[model samples]
Target: MEAAPTPTLLLAPMEGLLDFVLRDVLTRVGGVDRCVCEFIRVTGSLLPDKVFYRFIPELRNGSRTLAGVPVRAQLLGSDPSSMADNAARLAELGAEGIDLNFGCPARTVNRHGGGAAMLREPERIAAVVAAVRRAVPAHLPVSAKMRLGYDDPGSAMQCALAMQDGGACEVVVHARTKADGYRPPAYWERIAPLRQALRVPVVANGEIWNLQDAQRCRALSGGDALMLGRGMVADPGLALAIRAADAGGQGEEAPVEVRWQALAPQLARFWHLVCKDLDPPQRAGRLKQWLNLLRRRHPQAQAAFDQVRVMTDQRAITLWLQQLVAAAATADGQAPADPAA
Candidate 1:
């Protein structure tokens, strides 16, 4: 039998959670093949280039993160004509790719008749996708993401088929109904039939927090591609670890440890960028938000979170992080890169 091809690992486009700032820092850690920017809500307007740039700053840098990973812009809306018009502009702006978001389960998004609400109307899904596909150049890749269904897994295959029929080159199934709402057990098996039937690639996503989950997701979904979300945020080394295990061949591979010593610099760099780019009020919260998630996988992050939990001042947080980075560098026998620098 011919050998199976290597899997393509993508970073999931988490709204508010995984914006360009985190995307830049995480991609810098390496192993991610591509990233999808957070969903740009298209209402009825053509949405100026600034709107696209505001959401996906990478468009200014050749549609790629500073680390050079291509970032695809995602659009969420119910209006097929508006979606098609915006997609055409994104294409003209030189987006690396376009991804339609039909999987967002936020109440605000759903209340607007966008996101997973569209899953309730498969014909609408097909019309929007076909419209966007027609608007973009033939060489540009158009993709779509969706849950198993609005409330159950009943329409999973129908929605997947709709995406394929609408000219999406690839489709990513999050493996749970929107009603499941980021719950445990992502129903990886549900993706198997969709993978088998779809002509385009099917990428499995959801609840893959560790190497074991990645292995099992691939085994059950029977697909090579996977999209990482909170898992990657909680453990920045996840994608690289998954890649290492993949290359190591058929056995239980040891977990790849991402030491605090290594992560200290990334923390420092994230802070630097946050201070540089974001407003004063938003800066401190961003670091704490990341540490809150980081504490899921790293005990050290719990301590770090405790120290900065009440800090609203960016200067105070900067001082605390500098000390943390310096301490880590000392233990690792290296000179620290100043956190403020």
Candidate 2:
């Protein structure tokens, strides 16, 4: 039998979320080929060295992830020169690849002519990619991530073509138009045409919520790679499951109880990391975001999350979380007693 192809699964970089702790957890879960860091915003003339370090701290000692998987530094900006300068700084700091963000749908980002708005002018998109390509080392790859278009699907082909023409190694296309705002029924079929139109590799993104969705996306886009976002949050083991399924390996869906039990420790770790860096109220808010996802997976998670949600005191929250974990263990039949009850 011929050897099976290596699956290409990338972790999407979500701003204000998917921070270092989450990245570390997901990277160790296996099956993710690469992960992109959150976009480092570029607003002015100079690209500071500190900003590069803030986003890609692994550069401090030439580390990638603990698993040795590569992480790319993603940049969001409208200025070609500034983008190029930042890309150069990232290269100097040891980034294996640089990804340009042209798919961000946030109102604030688009209002500034950054993100998907860059697609409005194909010439500018081409210029930015070309400038960044020229500024980075010849061997270091530069890529672009984009949505179908601002309001329609028409500009995707043009924008992708421009990026390819400007020397981008690959372009990842999120199948929804900016107006869609992550609604259901992502138009994966739209990416197939763009794949046909561009010379560079085309990666399909958006609405790939499960292994089935990943399979459908591959069939629809006719592309080899995928970039996952919200899907991973709902189920962190999704990438691994997809790869296993593709390889004809039997994989079990992590039972709801098992998933919650596993996540308790990760949540504890994330809480500690956030408390060390943020104020009480800020830390609580971040914890709440994870709780929201946790609750979706296991309704009983809300009981545990409630113990920490309102407490601004880190010690109080930590204790509450410990009690919650104990309660979850008892509920899972893995321990002796329900401490909360």
Candidate 3:
């Protein structure tokens, strides 16, 4: 009897957030196969090795975490020649794979002819991917990440075909237009035609906040895989739950669901890593940012967020988190209420 394969869970690359530190924590949760580093912006000149190392210093460790998960480096730019040149450098630096970022919605990035702005000109996508493809070894995989379109969802199919013509090994559609910008009710079904049109595999992204959402996304996108961002951040155990259900009790790690009450110890570990890399202000901001997302899943996280909303000290926040965990454990006799409610 053959068992179904576990779905590939990818931790998304979110710039200015979810850096290498966060990647380490999430991938350690056991279901994530690999993670993409935040996008490194490439302009006219080739960036130095230090720039790549700064965003993904794990390159020194074979571009992997301590757990041995692979981390692909992602670059954001529109120039064919410069992008190819940088892609060559990344490959030379021992990148297992390279990802092109055409889906970023930052006005600054788009205004400079990068990110989702490139969607307006689908032909140029072919040119850039073709250039990068030619520069790298033909055997090496080059993938793209992008939104459905600039303003309308109508551009998705054409844009996806452009990547195929450009020689991308796979394309990831974020299930929303550049205009959607993290709004609710992602158009997961819109990705179906694009996935059906391409020769390469299509990975769906967006609005997968839980196991139910993940299942719904799979059915709607008809995708080969799923790329998780804020959803994984909110519930680090989501991918594990999905994997456990698929394995049908055959997997090594039993499924674990993370509730806000149970998340304090993990957050403590996450904070420890955050402080090692970021300054005081940055550390405080990072904690708040994660709590803001976790709040959606765990109402208890709201109390934690409120505790540190004004505090600049990570240590203080850690103590408050520990106390909250203790209180929650005591209140419900070990089973906390649903935070979503």
Scored by TM-score, the top model is 1
lDDT, candidate 3, at 317: 73
Rate residue 180 of model 2 by lDDT. Answer: 91
**Global local distance difference test of model 3:** 0.83
lDDT (Cα, tens digit) per residue for candidate 3, span 1-341: 98666567788998877888878777766688888999999998899999989989888989897668899889899999999999999889888788999899999999999999999999999899999999888777899998999998888888889988998998888998999898998999999988777888899999988877887898988854899899888878878877866666544222434555456656766787777777777888898899888887777778778878899866687676666656757754774322221
Name the candidate, 1 or 2, with the larger lDDT value: 1
lDDT of 1 by residue, 77-151 (tens): 999999999999999999998999999999999999999999998899999999999999999999999999999
Instruction: Give the lDDT ranking, best first.
Output: 1, 3, 2
Give the alpha carbon lDDT tens digit for every residue of 65-150 in model 2.
66577888999999999989888988888888999999999999999999989988889999999999999999999999999999
Give TM per candidate: 0.95, 0.89, 0.89
Give candidate 1 regions above 4 Å deviation. Answer: 1-4, 249-257, 338-341
In model 2, what is the error at residue 256, expressed in angstroms? Answer: 10
- How much lDDT does each candidate structure score? 0.91, 0.80, 0.83
- Pairs of colliding residues, candidate 3: 299-339
